[model samples]
Target: MLEVGQSTWRHLTLAQRARLLGRLHATVSASAEEWADIAATSKELEPGHPLRGEEWLGGPYAVLTALEAYRTSVRALAQGESPLARVRTDAAPGGRLCARVFPLTAIDGLLLSGYSGEVWFEPGVTEAEARRNAGLGQLTPTTPAGVGVVLGAGNVSAIPVLDVLYELMASNRVVLLKVNPTQDALLPVFERALAPLIEPGFVRIVRGAGDVGAYLTTHRSISHVHITGATPTFDAIVWGPGANGERRRRANRPLLKKPITAELGGVSPIIIVPGEWSTADLRFHAEHVVTMRLQNSGHNCIAGQIVLLSADWPQREAFLDALRVAYEAAPRRSAWYPRSDEKLQGAASDYPDASWCADGTRALIEIGAGDDATALETTEYFAPILGVVSLPGTGQEFLDAAVAHANEKLTGTLGANLLIDPAAEAALGDGFERAIADLHYGAIAINSWTAFGFLIPTLTWGGFPGSTLQNVVSGMGVVHNALLLDRVERSLTRGPFRPLPRSVSALAGPGRFSVLPKPSWFVTSRTGATVSEGFTRFRMDGNWARLMGTLVQAFRA
Candidate 1:
């Protein structure tokens, strides 16, 4: 398989690559229903369950977006235009160049109003340098870099497929994708959806446990490796186990010599800037916070694990109360991922004083200050548990402390979220922007969940650019950067503190500000599957009627 892909990948023309991606997009769109069903069944979700929306967005919808982006790039290359020509660039703090990638079209702005995002280039990358590197591999389409082995993630259905696309589109390499055992049931669906690459021998999907993965990682045919998993898993793969692993890590000597890129799990934090918010604001953000944590049943690598609140903020108690209420009201999800129960039990045992909102299937734990060394603080629980900690100070002081804690004390550098009221943000002035510039996270989201950085195909998704194998915190290298820039430093995504009524804010209700409708992403919504499907179709076709139907279904949800 590797030999076939290696030979075939370099022979394809730019136009041919665009056509192939278009075909794959069509295949995935056609198989959207089956793909969602496969994911739902694997995770024990009922038919038409709201969580199925997750599978759709993460699977077919995500692939479709990536394909469109790649096709756009290749088509531009076939012409005499640079793919970066259409991008809007500006200077960011610390002498970084920021490019606005999403909302490329007016319709995108209409559909996702009150939301915009940008990718930040590495510091000292002048506008000229960024434009030069933006079209990295497309200039030499026939140059092949050999075969890559993608160790698929089990938690999200889309991860394996996305990793394969990145290896093919970004690196111009063929892929041998090893599907995680937990999601092996979706092999048929993947085979059907990604038939273009498989038929041409550019990609191969296999199933395996640790032994199979180890063999492939050490295999001679594989030139590169990418994995979406836990930090410990990456450690065990790159270094031997137990004492040897510790020794190798200490001595900066790795057992594996191949180039590896990974997107590992993190103890992501959401810093809540001290502010005076209305009742509606508190309620809306409570649900928003809950959604960030509970999405994917808290199995997501970018899930918000810690809520950093201000000890001096007068509204702290009210916000915590609202969070507890929202957490309890949200629907419980089955513990689907491996060792979920054990992880949750360990957290509970380590912090017996932590507040629990568990009802077997779903749980939320709130921990206090002195428990900093406990598992809840240092470990990625990978379960439906959120830890809340309050720190001293107000205004910029609190923001600085939170950012320092996230950078110095957190387990990973993958992603982080900042939730600040517009008023508070304005008052902080330059201090707010400085805090964003200082954050060590690869993806920094302002007033939105960091997961959006992962979802947006144009945004660079990986750890902060400078991680060594000896201390690979979030795993190095990036994926899903449609512009194809090789010197990407981080991705910064910003959204409104409270999205406009016709936008995302409609999803949260029970307040006067809510005017639009319920959002399909809500796990409590029964018609989420129908709504999400309609939205996916709309995204593919851009039909007004389909969009209307999707909105109607959202209202019903």
Candidate 2:
């Protein structure tokens, strides 16, 4: 299957590629409900629960969006225009180019509300260089780079499909995707949805355990490899295991020579810049913090694990109290992802002083100040455990110290989030912007959760670029960058301090300008599935009736 795809993919013309992507878009749209159902069942989510919306967005909707973007790029290429010509670009500091990719139309703004995102090219990437390298492998049809192996992630259903899309569309490579054993129940669904690529011999989906993955990774026919998994897995694959792995890593020797790229997990942080706050503000952000930790049952790589707070802030205790209330209010979700229980147990054992909040089905362990090398700070607890660290400083001093800590002390450079009151932001002024510039993360979100950077297809998702085999912190390379810009350093997504009317933000407060019926990300909401599906449909087709229905459902919740 891989050899056939390797041979046939190179011959596909731009028009043919566009058509193939269009077919994929149709397949996903048609299979949306079934796909969502399978994922919900696998994750133990109730059939009609709003949390099923997570499956829809992370599964079919994500694939459909990527297909549309890839199709647009290929179609533009066929029309003799730059694939990135539609993007608006500006110059950032150090000669980097910032390309605004989201909210491409006014309809996007109307649908998303108060949200905008951009990808910054690497330093010294001029406008001309960006335009020149925008399409890279797709601009002019090139020979296939042989069969590529994609080791899929078990947590997010969309990740495997999107990884396949990136291989085919961005790099013009054929793919052999190995589904993670944890979620291999969806093999039939993948076979159906990816039939277009399979029929054309451009892609192949295989179900597998670790042994199967090991065989495929070492196969001579496979020219390159990409994985969305942990750093240890990458190490085991590239440098053997245990003592030998450490030896090879130190000697900079890799067993597998073929090029490998990965999107690994991280201990993501949310730096809260202290400021005066109203009760409404506190409530709004309390919900925001809870959503950040509890979303996807806390299995997400970009979940807000470490929350940095200012020790001198007067509202610190008030905000913490509100956070506790919000956390307890959210019903415990099923820990369905692989190893979630084990990870949670490890965290509990390491920090016996940790405050435990569990109702059997879900858990939220809070760790207070401890040594920097403690498990709570150093380990990527892929569960509902959040560590709160208080730093001394106020205003710029706080922001500067926080930035330094986040950049240096955090485990991975995958992504980070910052929550600051608008007044506090105004007070910091240029210092806030400077602080943002200094964050050594692949994606950063301001006044919002970092998950937005991953959810938005246009934003480049990966580490901050310079990782190697020996020091693969968050792995290497980028994905989900629809625009195909070269040398992308990071993605920064900014949102309004307060929720906009009709916005689906988790940060919406009691009296603030909120228009949603209920927060779609909340697993406790009875109508979560309906609201999620409605919002997704509205985004895909912009149907007013669906939007109205979703709003009504939200209100009912």
Candidate 3:
């Protein structure tokens, strides 16, 4: 199949592929509810469970949103125009080009109120250079065609399918996707949703565990390999496993000659810049931090594992208390990903002084100056455990220490987050953006979770691209970059520090009044399931009525 498609690849126009994506949108829409339900059930979410919304947003809503994003880019590419022209792009400080991807249209503004994101081109990339290089595979209507193997991610419903989409549209390759065993139940739905690509020999879905992935990656027919798994899996694929593999790895010799890329899991951090705060500020940001840790039962690659707080801040202890309260009070869900029980137990052993739930399923640890944070510093727990570490400073001193801690100690460079009081950020002058620029992460979310970078299709969703076969920290390349952007560095997702009703208050960053309530992605949200269902419908057809209904649900959320 790949050979046939490779022969015909040059003539496969962007417009035709655009229609294929259109069909995918329809098929996925028709079965969107079933898709979400199956995923939710597979992940131990019972009917009517609050976290069912997680599946809705992660599965259908995420893919549907990607389809819409790709639609815009494909149409422009079909017309021989730059998709970057469709958005607001300009030069930012340090001579890098920044494309404001979110709030793209008026509809985007209305539906995604108070949220915005930008993809920044790497340092030294001029506006003209980035614009010229934006579309390589898409604009040329030509590509080096071959087969790519996609090793699906188990924790997130959207990741595997989205990676396949990136392969077809951006890399101009047909995909042989091996479903993650933990998410195997969604394979049939994936077949149906992806039938447009499947029928055309552009894609094929296979199911299996590590052995199958290894087989596919090494197959002579495969040209490139991509996976969203751990670093060990990458090592096994790159150098081959066992003592021989270790020797090969140490020697920087790779067994597989083919090019490979990955978005390996990381020990992500949330740097909280200290400032004067009111009771409302503490509560709102507490929920923000809790939502970051507990979402998807902490199975997210970008989950906030360790929090860096300022020790000298007067409200530091108060804020930590609020975090403990929120962490305990947040709605509990099953840690559904494979091996979660063992991982959580390891975390419990590492932080013996940490607070734990009665069921021993969740933990929150506070690292004092004298304590060892070895586990938190080095491991991607990927469980319902969050650590709080206080640095000895305030203002820029605190910011400097936190950024150094995250960049120096963390396991992966995939994602990092910063939660700052707007006033404190203002006081930092140019230092805030400087700190953001200094952080060595692929995606940086301000006052929001880095998972937003994953959900937003246009944003480059991978780690900073310097890792080699020798040191597989986060992987080599990025995916879901529908615009076909190049010279990429990172994505920034900025959101208002407060939600609506409260956002109008004096403490809600003064002038920033948001229509957004608590995000539907929040585990504590009441209307996420319904809001995301409506969002999927709206993305399917652009029905204003459906969007209006979704807005109602969001307001309720």
Rank candidates, TM-score, best first. Answer: 3, 1, 2
The TM-score obtained by model 1 is: 0.95
Instruction: Name the best candidate (by TM-score).
Output: 3
Tens digits of per-residue lDDT for model 1, 157-202: 8888988988888888899999999888889889999999999899
Ranking by lDDT: 3, 1, 2
Residue-wise C-alpha lDDT for candidate 2, range 271-323, written one tens digit per residue: 88888787877887887888788888888888889888888988889999988
> Residue 379 of model 2: what lDDT?
88
Q: How much is 266 displaced in model 1, in angstroms? A: 0.9
Pairs in clash, predicted candidate 2: 49-529, 50-528, 50-529, 517-554, 517-555
What are the root-mean-square deviations of the candidates from the true structure over C-alphas?
Answer: 3.0, 2.9, 1.6
Residue 541, candidate 3: C-alpha displacement in angstroms: 3.2
Q: For candidate 3, write residues 1-557 as lDDT tens digits.
A: 86676556657788887887888989988778888999989988899887787887788888988888898888887787787877788776576778998867777777767778899888888767776777757766576668999999998888999999888777788889999988888888999998888887788999988888888888999999999989989999999999999999888888989999898979999998888888988987888899889988999888999998888889988998888888888887788788898888898788888889626668988998799988888988888999988888998888999999999988899999988766787899888788888888999999878887788888889998688889989888898887788889889998877778867763534435578898888776789877877777787778886687789889898
Count of backbone collisions in candidate 2? 5
True-structure Cα RMSD, model 2? 2.9
Which consecutive 10 residues in model 3 have the weakest lDDT in total? 504-513
Q: What lDDT score is found at residue 228 in candidate 2? A: 95
